[model samples]
Target: MKKFIHEDFLLETDYAKELYHDYAKGQPIIDYHSHLPPNELAEDKNFENITQIWIEGDHYKWRAMRALGVPEKFITGKATDAEKFQKWAQTVPYTMRNPLYHWTHLELSRYFGIDELLTPESAEDIYAQCNSHLKKPSFSTRNLVSKMNVEVVCTTDDPLDNLSHHITLAESDCPVKVLPTFRPDGLINIEKVDFTDYISTLSKITGITITDLASLGEAAKKRVAYFHENGCRLSDHGLIHAYGYDYTEAEINKILSNRFAEKSISEKEIRQYKSAVLHLLGQLYAEKNWVMQLHLGPIRDTNKAILTKIGINAGVDSIGDYPQAEQLANFLNRLNNSGSLPKTILYNSNPSDNELFATMAGNFTGEEIKGKVQFGAAWWFLDQKDGIKDQLDAVSNMGLLSCSVGMLTDSRSFLSFPRHEYYRRVLCNILGNDLKDGLLPHDMKWIGKIVQDITYNNAKEFFQFPSLVENLSLKR
Candidate 1:
């Protein structure tokens, strides 16, 4: 049988074989952004069932389920694992031309060591086999990380987390680095239900009263300090648009005052409160030298009933028509003027925002690798072939591909690591084709080296990997 993955090298034509061969050699992965849990890595947790690992928490499958008209019961509810597997297999072939098709097959090939495509006929057997593997002690989360060749993975987390898990992972002798990304978008989603609990939690975490803006700020500062102590060097924000309403600090303090009074705020006032909170967070990030990433412009929760039933991420998100440049101007202008901006990487879902977001990113000279500004690779629903190509082109044509980190999994699935290899192959295919023709120089060695650097080496260098510098393999 043919190997699903090849080690021979040079996935390009013979003319460019030597170059691609040299370029595709083994390099450590820098997965700087992901939704994976830190505690799972710390615990080296293993899944009990195939469904538990694949269907339990993954929103990708949830989206497909909604698309296929499968009820939520079979997805995240009472349906048996076997029943869910059956539904998924029925939908698999129809996922044609979707990235999920490739990812599912790739995972099957790589992890389960099964080359055959998953269909109704094969689902049960494949599920049984993979379930068996999932139960093995060697198949724990940390083991999965090692097998995926992940050197560093940053998981999205709250400022209030104890980070005990992150500390545990660091203390373990594991070579893979599991870090945290501070996601404080919760502070922006201030409704009565969320705000009350958030404040209570913040108070408990920081040992301070979160009654007013000052107290809230103080509590958040304590959380950020704890994160830093545990090796968190990054923060992330998800927004509908980069719009942050303008207001005087005193006027903003009034909302904090209102929240303290337990009074309901108008929708417009909520925007002001969020904007003020954003500026505060931005200042904190810069003060601490943390990387900040923004995922902007998802018209989220379009399916109103589904949203009401299931809460957010119910596969109802679509592209928003919000003003791109205009929406971003106010907030970015604040950061730019105050010079309180951390290293910023912006990801926008709307294709029209491509140029605007890229140019806006260019203005910051910011974060991670620093000019201090950078644009992110395609993300979420936009993490597709065409979207990725557009992002690479836009960044390369507008910014510098040399500074661009290439791709991040942004996944909840351990099996999704091949998405990295997929991105790398696509990059090589593009670059190789360019060099094969006359668009790029025919100096295979330099071109290949650059490709390798972009695929993995650059990511390793750009993100905070204070631990890896001690590794002897880093010298070469």
Candidate 2:
């Protein structure tokens, strides 16, 4: 049998094949947002086996394995790495029509040069082969990034994180620009039991005694400044919906004082506090010219039992049915009215909000900026082929697709870089089909340039990272 993933994989037409090969295939990736650990890149850590690098911290694979009746021991438990690989291989063939099947084979082919379908039958050989490759110096984390032609990768970071690893990467000879993105969900989530503890930690970090809302904002601003100096150009927030509740500065201060005193806070008070903090941070991000990314609509940690056992982000989350439009508009309008709305990217986990997010993004475009408020790439559960097509259609129909920044991994695994290629193929196929049907002009050069822009150039210009721009200039 021919390889499932070949040169023409996912390219259905001659135009599709031509566009992908000529315009999209060789473009360098700019993963402007992801959950990749910076310390691994800073240390150039090499995995001892494929499972260590691929299975660990990958909740997608773990979720699939659990669906196939694999026990936690094999998924994230005391099973040996070899056993986990066996369980994953056993689960692979059953994942047909799912994105994992394609991702698994693509990673195997792209990284290990092994195109054989992963199965219980072929598991041993493939596992051994991947392990052998892992032992090579070229398979180290930094080399893997270079192998994928990644120009820049911005890792999500906590506001209180020291970012010493990011500092190390910046000062080292590492080719890829690994920058940090400020993620202050902890600060925004005041309803959590450990909120005061997190505030205390932040106070210690900034040497600002957190006694009131003003001091809290002062400490947050200091951290934002520190992150900007350390090459951070983005801030990310994870929320079920936008917090746009109305409240005065006095009300927010009272709420913070109550929380600090270990007193009960009403739901209205919680929303008010969150809105105040988010609004304050939005202005600060604008001051520093940093992009703010809002990842919305996921109801996280639903399975209380599993969460208690595995902690958070163990794949128990699902797309939430939140009323996003009104609050989202209110928040953005408030920022825009204040003239402090930074360049923002809105990502929706629920597909029902596709056109809503697309049109909403179009609401706040800057005269000098192209697609300033962006409907970000299909995210989380929506990063698959069908979800990608739907998001692209929404952007093309409701907004400017050509001006939009393209795909990002948003993944923790180094091997997930082929997701960009997967997205590119889908993109070329869409445009190529339009050309074949006479829906678009037959000018390949013009369309090809647009494809190249969406694949690479758009993000480079949209983000405008100093080090990334300088490095790409040197290469030119």
Candidate 3:
């Protein structure tokens, strides 16, 4: 019997097969954004079992298990690792159409060399096999990343982080360049209850007094310089939507004073304050020549019961139908008008906003940069095959797909690098089908170069990380 995930998996035509195998398969991955723990990579930690690596902290699988009526003890509570693996195996058969089904099997096959379908019947042997593989010295975190041919990994970090682990990795003999991405969502989210506390933490870290917006911007600017000195070339922001409300400096300072005094501010004031902070940070990013990434449109933590019990990122966030266009344009235009619009990548969690994001990206594409404002890869709920294709179609139809920078994991798992491969296959299949239908000319070399650029070259150029450039030159 034919294996479900063969070499030509997801490649439906001969052109697709050739494109994937000949051009896309050999490219290195640049996971420019991920939630992977830098400490694990720095320590070269090895997992005790497959469940530790695969199931723990993987909310995607947890959501599926919950939908299948699996007990909380097995999902996230004190159930033994073996018991948790059993529950996940049982839930696998029911996840036929979900991306989890593909991701589970792909991770198993790629990492453990296990090709058998994950089901209750084959669960025990597969579990044992994965655990055995995890015990190998070659399965350490650093080794695992190197094995996947990853050139660079930019981990998400807060402005408050000292980046000791990144410093360690930089001074070590580790092959992959683990860089830090400056994420100031904590600083930008003034509406959170912990906003004052976060400001205190930032003030301590930067040795600045945060009495108002000016001091706060000064503290944040110091952090940006600190992060840049520590090898950061990117900044990330997670918001329901961009804040572009108009506010004078006095108004923002008053809003800050009220918030710091434990006074409740109106929604209008909240928007103005967030806009001011975001604009200040955007200027800092431009000054530092950093890439800015905005992950937008998700209404996070909707289930208050789950949120209260499990806290944030508890698999309760859903796509939001927020008004994105007007505010997003205003935010970008504000930065542009001030001559501080940095290279930006926009990721939309809602699939309905595909063209909206792609075209919005087009509106800010100048400044002698190729794809300066990218309509980033399909993100969150939209990382699957159909979503990937939809994003590609939107970019190709509304913008220049050839200039696209390609896929990212946006994941927390070290074993998720195969997503890049999955994306490549889907990309080749799309182009191949276009060729087959006579939509594209029958030119292999040019098309193949386009495939390679989207897979690797575009990102390499787009990010312009010093370590990546130095490493590529060394290879040459």
Candidate 4:
């Protein structure tokens, strides 16, 4: 048998190997979406050890360790960093057939030059070696980003954030362009307990009293402009599903007013309010030429006790089973009718919606742009091997795969850049396998260009990030 995760790992044929090594590997990453904290990059923070960087804030590993019967102490509790690393190494072998197994070794090899598999016996030496490297200036957050050949990073940010870190990076001669993405989930989900308080915070920031939907729209527009001034080119929304409920202006105004008055609104009213706000934001996105991303189908924080203790996004979330097609299509059509549909990307956390989303993406392609409306890469719970293949198949069957922009880490970890590499390998393998089976021609030059486009070029062209748009044109 072949060696584990060799240079041609996942590549089963000659075409696959060459496609990855020659065309896909050296391309710079445009990490258009991630949760990497800007302050860490701005301060150029260095981790104290492997666990600090790899274990902390990574819910993927937490979920796996929890599955292996690991206690909270070693996962996210008061254990020492070394203790956490030991627990993780012990859990690694059990992760075979899971994406984490590949990601773990890929990161170790790419970032730390460690080739041996992680296990309980090797944990101590590996931890010590990583800790020693962490102390070096080259391992600082900014340097780590540079080392990955990342061209741009768009960090998800709330509308109320001051974006001081983005400004700081812009002023420095930082190698990568670190920009902000406007994520207004708090503002959109008006039924949350913290909704009024979040609005109050936005009111304080914008000097606009958000007593009605109109004022809320005004406040959001102001923040959008602020984000644009700070070089933001994208906005993201996370929802159970897209909203399309129709509500009159008076009805929406009353909903917001009652919400601010500490009155209870029904679930239907909640959806109505959310739909109205999203449509308003879509108009703003179109006007500002910002790309809008919708991440749908998550039933979050299901374990109430764990949620009560560790809070949301503690890896207690699961895919939601929502009826996505009708509402999603309705929302897009509404935006299209109003000429307020910006360049859009739809991501489905539930695999059942993959074909639906891929088919729907074609219904809204803009005349001014190629692949103006896209089905985004597999996300969150669906970022694994089967999920990736399913999404690619759906998009290829129903949409323009050649014009599709590619993957993002969608992660909170710096080591997550290897995920992009993983996606590239999977993509090349799919294309190469077809060629080897006589389903595709052996036109290496054309196939190679398509791989490069998906790896880096499409995102560079799709987002038209100001820092790199000129370069994109030159490269083309």
Better of 1 and 3 by TM-score: 3
TM-score result, candidate 2:
0.98
Task: State each model's CA lDDT, in order.
Answer: 0.76, 0.93, 0.92, 0.91
TM-score of each: 0.91, 0.98, 0.98, 0.97
* lDDT tens digits by residue: candidate 3, 306-353: 889888878888899998999999999999998999999999999989
Pick the lDDT winner: 2
> Which rank order by lDDT, best down to worst?
2, 3, 4, 1
Candidate 2 residue lDDT tens string, 346-411: 999999999999999999989899999999999999999999999999999999999889999999
Model 4, range 281-368, lDDT digits (tens) per residue? 9999999999999998999999999889898789999999989998999899999999899999999998988999999999988876
**Could you list the CA RMSD of all candidates, in the order they appear?**
3.9, 2.6, 2.6, 3.0
Worst 10 residues of 2 by lDDT: 467-476
Answer with 3 or 4, whichever has the higher TM-score. 3
